[model samples]
Target: MAETVANHILARLREWGVEQVFAYPGDGINGLVAAFGESDNQPRFVQSRHEEMSAFEAVGYAKFSGQVGVCMATSGPGAIHLLNGLYDAKLDHVPVVAVVGQTARSAMGGSYQQEVDLQSLFKDVASEYLVEVNVPEQLPNALDRAIRTALVRRAPTALIIPADLQEEEYSPPEHVFKQVPSSPPAELRSTAVPPEAEIARAAEVLNAGTKVAILVGQGARGAAEEVRQVAEVTGAGVAKALLGKDVLADDLPYVTGSIGLLGTRPSYELMRDCDTLLIVGSSFPYTQFLPDFGQARAVQIDLDPGLIGMRYPTEVNLLGDTRGTLAALLPRLTRKDDRSWRETVEKNVTRWWETVEHQAMLDAKPVNPMRIVWELSQRIPENAIVTSDSGSAANWYARDLRIRGDIRGSLSGNLATMGPGVPYAIGAKFAHPDRPVVALVGDGAMQMNGMAELLTISRYYRLWSDPRCVICVFHNNDLNQVTWELRAMGGEPKFEESQALPEVSYADFAAGIGLDAVTVDHPDQLGPAWERALNADRPAVLDVRCDPEVPPIPPHATWEQMKATAQSVLKGDPNAWHLMVQGAKTKAQELRRGR
Candidate 1:
């Protein structure tokens, strides 16, 4: 049998050392699906419950593995379903390659079944690179460029393959005038660094300030030691962007937790008091949480010239690899003799944790949501990989959980989309099958898509060397994050029709699928439940009934926001009294700890 385009595409993927491709089946890709069996599955085809989950799983795999992730889909609807997750990859700057099937060339202009203009559809999300492979000669070059562009640019790319062409005989590009050939698979390496003069100027800004603050993002993941060295010499306090939550251990006395709306009080204070700022590899968008403009001299170091100096005003913008630039900047900086600023920052961090602990122990109607993450933080393994969905659960994951040791974590950072939490854990499992993984999700997200992915887990969990994968669901029958946003941001009462969720027993569903499961209603049961799930023989689900009225108030809530909440209550919110009581109790913990 002669080779076909579908066979050659898989061969190219194997040459690039891809281990798996997350995808779902359809008639449009029947050629490729058949090729998978013929190839002996060299690069395993990890089937997903839906096309959206396939894209999300690819994002998660890329995030954890530090390699380009690949996802595949059929034409029209399958291609359309990949947009949200592809946008998540684009916004978060994760590298992913999407391989999609299109209608046969014969039926394309005739408006055949599942026919869609995939090029116009994917133009924006895969703006970095997008192409349609017309002939077998286009195979190696097109697929290779897609992978290389995704790796070099850290963005999503796409390749559209017509259904009929995939089953046709393969042909190599000739060494003639119009034909183009690609080089063998290899990673491009470069070390970009700023000039010494600019590095010196940045050093001067840091050395001159009495109170220095450093902000790190996911871009700083590889330069942790350099960040710490710079902080120690400059007497700077470190604040992490949400995406960089695992870059530095919270155990460091000078490391303030996540900064922004889902942020720590100490982080807010760190920005308010600093005289100078150094932003490394972070494009944290909320500028209001940063130092007041013109009040502080700032310097920024980043690998991408496009993103550097855009988030904050900087005296010097060093466009270089974070690890290399920070390593270069270290020698130019002079140590601050006085350590008073560092001492103050550390003191504030200590008090903030105490307040967090106190708040987590507070009483709610059935159970406090913060306690779910707090208990997990206590028992999480040193090498665990944790993922959180976007909702009220993100608040506790940001504030209550402490990241330490070699633990890795991520979510839909820039997009802040829901439903990736569960699939992310599955991707993490494939990336590091020997390590334990956890997903913290809300009921709204679980119902949206998390439950179906559980079947995917049941099929694959036994393949993992370590079988601990826990999905902890915050089972409050409400769209809790938007409910709070309506009151705080829109000054509107909680509209039950849109805000309330229908209750579902996630534990019962998981148990029905032959996985370990538990439901916790009391605060005391949280610890034991987490322990059992984490130590289970297979993947587990934890469904805890949380209080819907508990407010996720921001640490630096403005008077206007407070006024809006008050107005919403007065305007007839259903749980006005319970809201006031829970808010008071939660806030009292911080006030008492401060005193």
Candidate 2:
């Protein structure tokens, strides 16, 4: 049987188990669609309002499923539009494959319609790039290798398929394709970190301090047990970066809380007062949060050797597996109760937690961002899977929510694309259907990417992002209030142009797409809407008309951000003393809520 290049490409994608593809149309890419129309093997084609959003939808799909997501675009402006999503996927290590239809094959590198170097445009973002020059053999080889690199390396990849190749009739080689291997957990090395002499010196310096603090990042996640062990042996209080939220349980007695701009009182006070700070598995981007090494000694250990001492000045740098290093450190430490230090920090932790929890349950006429997150925190089963799309909504969920249970889970579009909230929720529910899945998506974000992706697959499609999925979108009409703050600075607020408050009734759109959707305009209806969504076996969308008046606080804010804090007003301005008093009240509030 003869197959066009487009058909062959579709065949490869089907082999990859890709049933959902998000994209926008272009002249050069028409043949690709035609090829799908021509065959029984048509992959699910979704039309995204914007190209960047499509890429984001892809990453969201990938992050939850741990499978490579596929997206497509035509040359020139269409291809350029994909950069934002591509970068997001690249940074977060989500596997993706973009099928970008390029300038006609004859144009090559010379002047031609929509001719820009797709290779160079995507070079920094993707781990692998392949331009299909051969319609038959080379194209298939490129497709296979690109998928392999993306799935195996856990990075976004690209293939620039020439427009002409899509229309070329060719025969595919006869060979059954096997999916790629799953990434295995890393094996621990048999050696210690920083050598015996360095360890001895580090231990001596750390032991000299009356107040010792620990900061654990995501890189510390795998070594959680080892971290607890070392903290017990060393008597160090613990905190984490926002990305490391789940690295340890929030209620771990020694666990102070999250640190950095979004950090709490327990972490901030300890950091300010500690004579020694130990950083593990985290290269928290903000250097301001780190204490001065001249006053307090700092020691860091990480899996990536290059990260040590790069973010902050360090008295000691230990390079190796974090788990292994901690394992080694556990035995060398002498435990002494720093009653004064622990008692003081623990009080602050308690007081500060209370205030945050109070704001979470605040009842305003319009729904406060806190209420939305708090309600979500309450209704969602402890084991429910949570997926986040990029924006303030995602940051808020990561920061304020308290997740419990051994089987609890959350995935972020660490790639930073919006509009993935709904579709990713769909994918996550499919991945862990027995466990309820809730996707928190902003209204602005849901419009850009997920609207069509959800609307496109209305009926039974078990494979592509699972049609059985259900998600709740916190509908906000404006673009990211967080990025708007960033743009207020001199920096270019990239991707802001994609924001659209579509007038279309999202619930009606969902209905049109064959899924149950209900919009909650008032707070009274919100709870019932969510309950109904949870009860349904088929995929459903609960659209809560979120208050655009309330702005959001991101996980990592800057000194600049502190000035802009308007969502809630405490007893005093956020000066150091004010923070201590105010933060204490916050902690007390959280403690009461937990009870």
Candidate 3:
């Protein structure tokens, strides 16, 4: 029998360094599924219980490995199931290639069973690229374009392949019965560098300012040393966006934690006071948290020109690779010897951390979630990969989990979707089998997606000799973030029942799934629980009972926020008073310290 288009596609996937593709089976994609069955385990297809999880797993794979993630689904609903996770990849600006099956070519126009116009459905989400392979000859071209577009644009791309075309005998433009090559031409990749004039202009703007602040984002991941040097020579303090949290050690005198609602006090102060802002590869959407336009002159560095001034108007825009632009601009800058501004920022960072340490150590009946993040920050392996779900768990992780050198991590990014944590860990573990993986998820998000993906981990987990992956669920039994948001907005938690979750025994569930599990209720057991989770030879779940009332305080609370919180307390909400007191004690104390 002649080779089929599906076989050719699978062969190409393997050659492109894709060892696995997250997928779900359906009648529409039987040809592709059968092709996988004959590939001798090359480009192994990982069967996820849900198509959404498969896409999320693929996103997780790309996030940790810096490679294009691949995911496939059958026609119609299976294709639609991928939209959520694909949106996660699109918003996060990660590379993902989604291969979606379509009904037979003959059935497409007639609207046969499971036939849907996937290209139209995926258009907005796959803004970077989307194509259909209706002809057998279009397979190689579609695959090449989709992969290249995803890699170059750093966004999700999609290919809709009809069942009839997929099963047809593969025939290339130039080949008869020959084996087709899988990988595309190597020269299709290039790195952009900003012009010398642009770099010089950015440096001039930096040199003109006495008090400079640098805002770093995910784009600055590999340029850590250059960023440090730039901060040092320019006497600038660095504040990171949540996605860029791991770029520098939190202990650095000038390094501030995440900026925004989950930001550190030092970061808030940095943005509020800087005379000039040097933004590196961050499109931080919250302009209110940024310095006022006229308050600070700005220079932004980004690979994409469209994003340069979209966040904040800039005096100079440098378009190029982050590391290269910074390296070239360093020499053009006039070094600042004045330590006064740097010292003030460093002092603020110190005080902010001191407050953080206090909160992390605060004794509560139920374990404080921040303490879990703090302990994990201390115990995280040098080569670990960490992920967090959306909600209070993400907020706590953003605030307390300090990133160490060479450690990799991911969150939902611009999409901010929940339930990707466990899938991310599974993907990371597959990418770096020797390294440890950890995921932090909330009770709400855990029930949404973590439970199913945990089973996914259990199936293929034995592939690794040292399968050390920890899934830490903050089992607070409430939609804590939403509850706190209501209070922050001056609404009583009277509707709290709507946001409440049914009690779940995640530890018991994990034990039933063939993994060691532990439940940490008291603060004292927190450290020991983490220790056990980290060392387990199999995947482990640490279900920690954390306080539902502790608010994830904003970096700087406005007068209006204080009023809203006060009103909530006056409304007879059980936990409102405690939350208000916590905020007053921590953020209010920071304000007093500044005074």
lDDT of 2 by residue, 1-595 (tens): 5678888788777876777677878987888888767765368676666787678668766765666788899888898998887787776666788889888877877888788888888878874555544455555667877777787555788888888878888555445454222222222233446687777777776777778888987667668898887677666788877657767776666677667655665676677778888899887767667666476788888756656788778888888777877777767787767567777766666665566667655543355555666666666655666666666676566666665654233444344555556655644543444556667777776666667667543533344343335556766665655544543232333243454355557787787777878887776776677677766656788776665434343323455545434222332222324323433443445556445
lDDT of each: 0.93, 0.66, 0.86
Residue-level lDDT tens digits of model 3 in 1-595: 7999999999888767889999999987889998998888679889888999999999999988889999999999999999999999989899999999998887778968887878789999998889888777776877987888898899999998888788899876555554333446353444577888888788888999999999999989878899999999989999999889888888788998899998888999999999999999899999999998799989998988778889988999888889888889888888898889999999988888777777777765488788889899888887888999989988888888887777877799899988788888877877888888999999898899899888998898988666998999998889888777887875565366678799989999999999989999998898888889898889899999988876788887788876776777788777766665656565555565565
| Per-residue lDDT over 1-595 for candidate 1, one digit per residue giving the tens place of the 0 to 100 score | 9999999999999999898999998877888988999999868999999999999999999999999899999989999999999999999999999999999988988978899999999999999999999888886999999999999899999999999999999999989887789999997654799999998999999999999999999999999999999999999999999999999999999999999999999999999999999999999999999999998899999888889899888999998989999999998889999999999999999999999888888899799998888889999999999999999989988888899999999989999999999999999999999999999999999999999999999999998999999999999999999999999998899999998888789999999999999999999999999999988999999999989887787879899999999999999999999999999999888888877
C-alpha TM-scores of all predictions:
0.99, 0.74, 0.96
Model 2 residue 196 lDDT score: 76
Which stretches in model 2 have alpha-carbon errors above 4 Å?
Answer: 1-51, 65-78, 109-113, 127-154, 163-210, 324-333, 339-346, 406-418, 426-435, 456-470, 475-512, 518-529, 545-595
| Residue 475 miss distance in model 2 (angstroms) | 4.3
Alpha-carbon error at 21 in model 3, in Å? Answer: 0.3
Query: lDDT winner among the candidates?
Result: 1
lDDT of 3: 0.86
Q: Flag regions of model 1 displaced more than 4 Å.
A: none
Candidate 1 vs candidate 3: the TM-score winner is: 1
